[model samples]
Target: MEQERLVLEVDVRVAQPRAPRRGGVELDPIDRDLEYTGSLLTLLDPLGLLGGVTVVALSLTHGAFFLALKTTGTIREDARRLGTTLGAVTAVLAVVTLGWLGLLTGSAWSWATTVVAAVALLAAVAANARGREGWAFTGTAVTAAATVATYFLALFPDVMPTTLDGGRSLTIANASSSPMTLQIMTWAAAVFTPIVLLYTGYTYYAFRRRIGTQHIPEPVAVG
Candidate 1:
């Protein structure tokens, strides 16, 4: 199941590798280059940081999420206790990421992007406080999506830029693969992704109910 989902995700990304441009409104070299530089040092990296941080965030997010779902009414081994610990850690990461984002982008920030990120952080915290499982997970998803979208949108053409020599920076216009390749991947994704999604959804529905200690039979003693 995880493998199928990953395959679908790879297809999705392959179909659309180049991120959003800065609405095609070119910034002067000073502004354009500085924005990228500031953002980079502030912990947003194209080839590395965002993806790496996102994977960590997603793992922490999943830890909290499943803990919320499967732990309700499960007192034998209080999953919420572990879930709370995970939430605390994820919250710390989220706060740090949010702070990193604000340090650079807040002043030069787009209100839409910044606001969503802020709201996401707050939502996660609040949902956890109230034990709202769905909302807590939703907040994590929003936080990841909004942060990624904001960074990519701001990044625009440049795929990766360096302070040493801005001349060599990679950009979407130059870095993208062939259009035909993307189209082929798009068709492939369209064929397989829905099936994977359906199966995943069905499994979740099948296991929708909460579990308790009684669900686990006692262990037999060994001879």
Candidate 2:
């Protein structure tokens, strides 16, 4: 809702005189940027609104954790279960994404990015099947990053094109913030982003080792 409102507010395409013909961006004309953003927003809107599904699922999964310790073990078994589940989902999504890529290719978007995304997803599936958790994680990350990279590649010169007038579409040069603001943002990101990344990477590396159910300690009540 915030983004939709922002798009409606900041889009001064009406005043710009060159905006595309004012009909909604039709998938047929295949405006890659609009198609990508519209579809992504469609996916995200529900994900955001329906995020409580994760919390509910998490609550349910806690039972498995307890049962694991008392029965056949949980965390390690969950890891393998997750691997199988994610592998199946990834494979299915890969096939669907490949079909989506074919549509994107027909629409004249960058096919190279699709290839990268597919390869990364394939690597993830392979690694998951082989029980290489770290590699699988990296592959999944690469697939996600590649997809975002492709979105930008598809967005080329236009930042946001008004369906009312393609000519009025915002270009990178025109859409950029003032020089001073850009410089401040650049500096801020440079200073803080590396520190945050280092901290996060250290945490992941520290927890890289394996643990069996036997290693799990008993919970104690707090006074």
Candidate 3:
């Protein structure tokens, strides 16, 4: 199932590599280069690919930690083992990728988030080692948050850099909606955010119990 999903993802990426560029009025250097090359292989940016892999590793590690927290017996033991191994891999990949991004961006905010992400990942690994699954989950959550924050902080001010000489880059100032639109969005978010949060919290609370193989029903053979 995982392999099939990955294959489908790759096919989608190959078929619609420009999906990310849609709805953007201006092109960044990488996007412009992609356009110039017009090849599916051109989508392979080493740093970007590393970052993507790091995220995937982090997600897998997170899932393992979650399973360790919510399962019993052999399944929990397996989850712990898998989580530890994947956490180590995630730490290495995250450190390299985030450090590279921090240096490339050269911003205090980016560097700060990079450090936070590294520290969070380390904490998660340590927590998992100590059999503290909850803390491990929290740590991985923080790491994911920090990673995303670093990316956005690095891209601040200028949403996209100009590829052509003398071309105006897409900036937050240029890309932002009108004040009225912003106001409406702010009000709407304020009104709906709490309701959404309440619903999510209640949903999680309802299904918070741990489960094991014993909970599974035997499949009835239809003759």
TM-score, one value per model: 0.63, 0.60, 0.77
lDDT of 3 by residue, 136-221 (tens): 99999999999999988987877655554445656788779999999999999999999999999998788788888998999999
Output the lDDT of residue 12, model 1. Answer: 93
Cα lDDT of model 1 by residue, 1-223, tens digit: 9999999999997784232223231222222333442332334333245446645855676566666666546551354455456656665655555455454434455346756865875677567666776677777678777777666655565555433333345678656879998899999999999999999999989988877766888999999
Ranked candidates, highest lDDT first: 3, 1, 2
Error of 2 at 159 (Å): 2.7
lDDT of each: 0.59, 0.53, 0.81
Name the top lDDT candidate: 3
Q: Give the top-scoring candidate (TM-score).
A: 3
Q: Write the per-residue lDDT of candidate 2 for residues 78-133, one digit (tens) a residue.
A: 75465556555554555454444345332245467767766876776566566555
Off by over 4 Å in 1: 1-58, 74-78, 81-89, 98-111, 220-223
Clashing pairs in 1: none
For model 3, the superposed segments whose C-alpha errors exceed 4 Å read 1-27, 30-43, 218-223
Model 3 alpha-carbon miss at residue 202, Å: 1.2
Answer with 2 or 3, whichever has the higher lDDT: 3
